[model samples]
Target: MTIKFRFHPEKAVEAAAILLKLHGKPMKYIGLLKMLYIADRLALKTMDQPITGDRYVSMDYGPVLRGVYDLIKGQPVDSALPLWSKYISPRDSNYVDLLQYPGNEELCEEEEMILKQVYETFGHLDPFLVEELCEEEEMILKQVYETFGHLDPFLVAEWTHDLPEWKDPHGSAIPILVEDVLRSMGKTEEEIEDISQEAQREAYLDGALPKIFG
Candidate 1:
């Protein structure tokens, strides 16, 4: 059975604040998004689940966390608008500021470690450079897709394989599923259940599960 992922807005707010703190200054919205994406990818690789559990999509620029991207843009869903407005800056500005610190109650130690690692690795880099890297990855996926067509074996490799929890939609705009991401990581059903349950519990404790899962 496929497991559907749910977004945790409280966690997203906390993650954004953590990135801002690591950045040590206001951050370009795009750059912040890139860092969050990298951290989520790292989490999926090591923990079998993403931090925010936001749906991902392969865009021309790179893979994006759909809900988090919207939140960054100040256009979050109705349920997320209050928390997003209280914490995140307007997206029209060149950079975003943390209005208040969202505590780390939503994050586990491992997730915090991955966020720190991602920031240390890529936070100082230019946002455009990060976007270019993502474009390059997309190019590779596109080439492989064209060469192999859409057969399951070839598509699986080209779309996921050793890649970071991303799937090429083969020219279509289908959103990648969390189930596919965990599968790409070779997580067993038990592992998936454990990760998902933990994430849900965290969100519930943070009061985000009701808003997202309702």
Candidate 2:
């Protein structure tokens, strides 16, 4: 059986606030969502848990934290609504502003470092451009899952090395996946499923089940 993950609205709001403060200006909703997703992904890769523990869904732009996305749009999410309304700007605006300072209690030192690193890496780029890049990354990630059926970051990185999209001009080790390469090579569905299931089983044994399942 599949298990659904829980969302922490307070943490989501706090995270958004932190990102806004770090940015030192208003951020577009799309951009803020991408930053939050990257931070959560990093946390999941390193700490065995995500910052908000929100459900991730693939969208046209990229992967999004479903609950947080709703909150950003000022939707009435029961747990996060009050706090979100209190500190976050209205959904009518394309730009999100931090109405209050976020306390650091919800985020740990490691999580902060990951968020900081993400900001330093992508903060200067246009949000729309970042979204476009993320769309490509998301497609690659889906192929990786379909081909490998696992969430092991190291293995995924190694597998992505052979793909044409896997470029490193700056020598910075960005995360990538290999399923697209497999697809290009025309691997059969049966073969892909068999290999993906085996890899997913290994991932589960490695304690990555909850992060993905949840």
* Alpha-carbon lDDT, every model: 0.58, 0.55
For candidate 1, the per-residue lDDT at 1 reads 40
Name the runs in model 2 displaced over 4 angstroms: 127-214
In the range 91-112, model 2's lDDT, one tens digit per residue, is 6567778887756665665665
Best by lDDT: 1
Clash-forming residue pairs, model 2: none
After TM-score superposition, what is the CA distance of residue 26 in candidate 2 from its true location, in Å? 0.6
> Weakest 10 consecutive residues, lDDT, candidate 1?
128-137
What candidate 1 gets wrong by more than 4 Å, as runs, is 127-173, 188-214
Q: Root-mean-square deviation of each candidate, in angstroms?
A: 10.9, 13.2
Q: Across residues 84-141, which tens digit of lDDT does each residue of candidate 1 receive?
A: 7787777757678777665565666666666655555455544300111222222222
Task: Give the TM-scores of the predictions, in the order they appear.
Answer: 0.67, 0.59
Q: Tell me how candidate 2 scores on lDDT.
A: 0.55
